[model samples]
Target: MPAVTVDSTLELPRVPVPPAEGTRQRPVLSVTTAPRGFEGEGFPVHRAFAGVAQRDLDPFIHMDQMGEVEYAPGEPKGTPWHPHRGFETVTYMIDGEFEHADSHGGGGRITDGATQWMTAGSGILHIETPPEHLVLSGGLFHGIQLWVNLPRANKWNPPRYQSIEGGQATLLSSPDGGALVRLIAGDVAGHRGPGSTFTPITMIHATLRPGAQLVLPWRADFNALVYSLSGRGSVGEQGRPMEASQLAVLGGGDALSVAASARPDERTPDFDVLILGGRPIREPVAHYGPFVMNTREELVQAFEDFQAGKMGAIPAGKMPHTAPGEQRPV
Candidate 1:
């Protein structure tokens, strides 16, 4: 929960309150709780986008809320070397540290509040793992990995990477000085974040003090969603209950709101949420284990190309160190 913060919200620039009369407050369409699961190398994760309709999540293929768990010494784990195509992977590290390396020469360390954005456009091979020291002396590890679907036209663009440091995010406050909004990508109220995106989208991590409300003017063309990261809260004017690991898909409107309950869950003192929206791609989607494409034929071709080594080769002497008893990928 210490992704980014300020000693006092009163010191930050304020997000102006939307006019009440002219703007429509988005209604909550549905609220779903993420089911727990284990991800790469047996790390815990919550499948945040589960049970949501594909149309509603268009331009966003999948997401996983990787552990709010505290790990003991020698227990940290990460993904094996894998190939991906036709999409982008955004890894935001909220607490612990993760190291990323790819076949296309894109690699970096993403730690506390930083983000590593990798566009696996066309095709690429990559690996994400806790650093050796973190592996030896385990600590809290929490983060999110979101898969952003690329439009058919841009799916084949050359691979690229961006390392956005924690302090790079645009920080703003609620007019009442009750919330802190960290803009990681896209524009909000004419203020832009650091990460550039192929798809038009906005990603914000906002924290609201107990009983505080955060309202933002939203783009009418983009679909909106709010996912609770910690504590208890409510979404929309109707006051749909929201808690940790719950996602609320909002109906069409000119603005959106989220409020923390006066009595938040004991786990956290404030309610934190991830608010995101993107212009719908509105194209057919064919997704598999690691590839997202517009058609089954393209997915098949992606696998063939990957197996044929067209994605790129592992760097010399830099093969990922496999865990004991873990099988190596072919």
Candidate 2:
């Protein structure tokens, strides 16, 4: 008998392997009620997991949701030039426009449904404010800003920036057509997102129709959380319900299940949820004002550098327009 070799055309029956025990456990969700904090003088913001004890939200140091309030003409205010070091800043605009300028000669405009990710590796001075048109005419302003910490090894890396338009994001819809997820980073439904990240992280802006459900897979090592932006929703296997402006911290698990509440009397029929997670950095965090570093000495150096004009100043003139093809630095 001749030796038989599996032909290239041979199709083998595939068997699914069960996930390891303990790894497949459904996550537990706990609601975290974050208080309001003012930024840039008057901008009201809700900080998720605020305070030192809650710093367990690693990789993700801070998360802020800016005003859903409508600004009257000439009342729109924004942060002036400030310095940051040793981390990254992510800004997502839901409505209105934000003009930004950074020390690396990086400047651009992010409008509704757009995003800006800036890495202040060593240090960078930047300004983010509403454009003149919006400042004068006034309009609704709503957005989110997240601070992602960098490992100590990469804290002094060169600064970089990236901007992503809403259209460029990977949008995935559920099979039942009741849930939609806009992936800014990481993966969803086998589709990757547009943003580049130093660490493994997932950011998904999800919307669920009334009474709809979504079961999303997540890495077991990642620390995950769900933030309710609007309406109401239940998360995790325990069905922990959360309302608007609340944060749901999740425990170790491989998957998360979320469902939007059925509200007949509510004007908004859908629920908005922001799901974020990242692998822990597990390092010391020494932060002061806009600077975040692993040591107090490094934090001091950042301030000294900014005062000594190390971080270049924004040019005194009209805001420069971003050229085509310009992308955020990786």
Candidate 3:
């Protein structure tokens, strides 16, 4: 794998918002629980959302919350090389480190609070593995990976990569110092995230202090949902309380409010949440394992490309941390 860097002083463009003088009217539609499953070898995960049979979550096909579990020494595990096409992958680390390498000569590392956004346009093969040191020492490994679907027109665009450090994420706090919002993509409190996307979307990792309240604006047309990552919280006007690992699917509205429930004798009384959504693509989707295409023919073609060695290959045996660039199709 090779080191990928971004300009330290680069500025992300912000999404405009109207004045915030009036009351917000967002509503809670239903709540859903992400089923648990094993992925990438034996890594345990929670399937927060997916697009199966129908495009339930358009512009976004899948999301998985990697383990918050602790690994014992000599028990390391990770995903081996795999092929993908027609979408982008966003991996956000909450506590652990992950090294990634792709066939397009793109590679990087993302650790605690950092993010790796990879565009698997057309077709590409990649692998994600934990560092060997972690395997020996044993520690907590937690993170989230999202599959953002590209519009039909941009599905074949060239593959690209962006690596953002945890410090680079925009952090916005409430006026009363009760809540903190880490904007990874889209905008929050007029501050934009570093991620560049092909579709209109927003992703915010928020934490609210006990009994604290926060209001945030969102586009009316975007379908939205909030997942309680940790602690207990109430969402929308109904004050429906939810515990960690529960997801609240929200109805269309201009804005949303979230509050954490107070807990006595708790040292760190904070509720963590992941807020995500985007405008629906409303187009037909054909998916097969790692590949997602608008048609079955394209999906089959992706498999053919991989079998024909068009997606490139990872060198045999131990891979170097950095390697010479490989030629790829334009």
Q: Which numbered prediction scores highest in lDDT against the true structure?
A: 1
| Model 3 TM | 0.87
Candidate 3 ranges with C-alpha deviation above 4 Å: 1-24, 50-56, 264-268, 315-330
Q: What would the per-residue lDDT of candidate 3 be over residues 250-314, giving only the tens digit for each residue? A: 87778888889987125346788889879888878887799889999998898788878887676
Model 2 CA deviation exceeding 4 Å by range: 1-26, 51-55, 264-267, 318-330
Clashes of each: 0, 3, 0
Q: Residues 25-88, candidate 1, lDDT per residue (tens digit)?
A: 9999999999999987799999999999989988899999999989999999998888899999
- The CA lDDT of each predicted structure is 0.91, 0.76, 0.77
Question: Which is the better candidate, 1 or 3, if ranked by TM-score?
Answer: 1
Model 3 per-residue lDDT at 151 = 85
Candidate 1: list runs displaced more than 4 Å. 322-330
Note the residue pairs that clash in candidate 3.
none
Measured by C-alpha RMSD in angstroms, how accurate is candidate 1?
2.0
lDDT of 3 at 74: 68
Q: Per-residue lDDT tens digits of candidate 2, residues 1-330? A: 000112321132211222455446456546777688878736778877675254558888888888776889998877757778899999988778889988787778987778899999988877788899998999888888999999988998899999988877776665566776778998754678899988779998887779977777787888888988778878886788888788888887787777899862274577888899899999999977888899898877877787777866666663533221221111
